[model samples]
Target: MSDKAKLVLGDKTVELPVFTGSEGEKAIDITKLRAETGFVTLDSGYMNTGACTSAVTFLDGELGILKYRGHSIEELAEKSSFLETSYLVFYGKLPTASELKVFEEKIASYNDVPEGIKTMIKAFPKDAHPMAVLSSNMVSLSAYYHDLCAQDLTPAQKDEVIVQLMGQLKVVAAYAYRHSQGLEFIKSDGSLDYCSDFIYMMTGNKNVSKEVAKALDVLLILHVDHEQNCSTSSVRMVGSSKANIFATISAGVDALWGPLHGGANQAVLEMLEEIKNSGKDYKTFLAEVKDKNSSSRLMGFGHRVYKNFDPRAKIIKVACDSVLKTLGVKDPLLDIAKGLEEVALRDEYFVSRKLYPNVDFYSGIIYRALGIPTNMFTVMFAMGRLPGWLAQWKEMVEQSGFKICRPRQIFTGDTKNTYIEIKSRS
Candidate 1:
């Protein structure tokens, strides 16, 4: 027996013997800590947890590599459409010619929400947040598809539900917006592409140029899946409790509502509005972000992972320029965003943190150009990530050895206290 820590990561087991320091104190080589445990913290003060070794996506932060279903993200952004990438992420492969066709047909078929659901949506106050309505509507979907909730459902039945959820999420999301605005529900056009149809459903118009649709598609692809992110983890945790898919995904939606997560895009717009209202130019806004006392943060900047930079942001930057240029839309905020990125990149704090503009940065500008309200941005995100969460939930159940997720908490309350009866006290 060695007096060292043992860790297990993935399938690897490693044991390290205790180290004796010169002062007779035990010590660990902070810089030499290797990943051995499935999920253990290293002496270097970084967490190492084996969430899952997913074959669905690979992210190499140092190398700036991101792949979905084994295809390079750059390739997908340029060549493959968003729906195709979505199919890749959910189904674990690029859809073939016939498969893509059938997949599009299946998605197109689910373009309209039921009238009852729309009616229910209309009952909510117009002032209610769109995300709240979306979350409620998503949970309500399970009640409508009560038959699909059977525990002993066949594989075919499960796949059908998955397809249904992916397709219907758009309708549910768009209807939430329309219902809030007192506008009539716009049905999806079977002829237009998936993202184009979704944009049409929300805008009540089919005038989305091909360029805008393509940009929106790339944006959707970028957000499709990020391995074990907060919202994704929320879905898995809820699913681990044996909750039905709809409920699990609804929980995920609630998690994504946080300002730091899917809500970041909304925050970005808010920050931009603040800067605009302040009468500050790009330089002044950049300085404010750098000042510690100012306590102002450049929204849409920085990320948790990808210490080098966010690959998705890079892709979106290109697409953002192209879409805005092609549409002849002039947004000064775009220039301000670019200036902020430039100043942050040259600064020390941002460089050390590997903070870069993430998917949230360009997303708001694109949504603005498309006539989608800022409040609806996260709803759109929820719609795009639905397939990813569903696929993860399915994979977690089918392939991965599932476990009930229950985390521990350190107790801090008083151990004991005396209580007196009310009558006795009186």
Candidate 2:
């Protein structure tokens, strides 16, 4: 096999070195391609680009595989808590018993945000989106910890910021949810585990059931990381400019706010609601989804990355069922969702296209069963995804020979045009 790829130009030939990942994924090293050949590859939507190498998470979409720090998602979801999974994702190893205790304590200690931040949350309109409020509060953390946000930091300071962000983000999310309901903020309770504490704060329930909390923990673990996703990429891109961690993560929150990303779960719930309220049966509604000319669309039946079934979806489906049963909450939307899922799974139109159920499919069902409003779903996603964003940002900054992320583009517009004076325009 050749060690390099030969690229031929009009009268020039260049040999680009080939690099392979540990998993045998191969890429042509293009670092010197433009320098040598004066030509650049155009990958729209970055569909074929590998921006940077990472060890945080490995995903094989075709194989339906996802792992963090080399631990399978199935194993982690079954045996690990959200905080432990977070430690593994951020620090690249499962903490020792004592190390885990210290990590949890540090995060619990940083859970409380400044009182002024609560005041800020209260000032947003009652109908304001929680994501907007959450992002605002995240960036504002820089105001409280200026030293930690500096470009150069001691190793201890970096560790503190990581723990601090992980702890405070849930509080901010809870406060944002409370503010949306025009309710008073609930202070964090260090006595409870991370997911239980978050549920308590969000719902003002001190005695949250163990089953519910564990379900939430599994969901968070599933979302902790995926390889170079939109929001994770946003974090790395913003952090590359030497921006503070708070601002960089805020960029991720904003990116995740899009309907096509973290908001997909919320959209899934909304689609179910629409179907239920339309008085149409699941089979009838799905017919519209299959129609090429119909405006109706399926929100969570497929994924962009996973050519096979989504591994997270399988785990969360069980959790979703368990939580709904544990709470004894009967939501009509769940019936509709199940009906759609059953048809989509066996229907030739869907099966042939591999449009299977994804993580977003059942997550909103679980969130709704827990009494979380639809608007708050993405905020929950952001909370779950924070560790991944932090790890990516931390990895990018600490890497040797790191460069600012500046993507090249092929412009498609008028090359040169004279500006017309407004008064003289005919």
lDDT of each candidate versus the true structure = 0.78, 0.89
Per-residue CA lDDT of model 2 for 280-386, tens digit only, reads 88788889989999966688877777878999999988888788888998888888888889978888888888888888899999988777889999999998999
Worst 10 residues of 2 by lDDT: 295-304
Candidate 1's C-alpha lDDT?
0.78
| Regions more than 4 Å wrong, model 1 | 1-47, 281-296, 420-426
Q: How do the predictions measure up, each by TM-score?
A: 0.86, 0.96
lDDT of 2: 0.89
Residue 44, model 2: Cα distance from true site in angstroms: 0.9
lDDT of 1 by residue, 236-279 (tens): 88888878777888899999998888998999988887877787
Minimum summed lDDT over a 10-residue window in model 1 is located at 37-46
In the order shown, the candidates' Cα RMSDs to the true structure are 6.8, 1.6
- Clash count for each candidate, listed in order shown: 7, 0
Alpha carbon deviation, residue 233, candidate 1 (Å): 0.4
Clashes of 1: 7
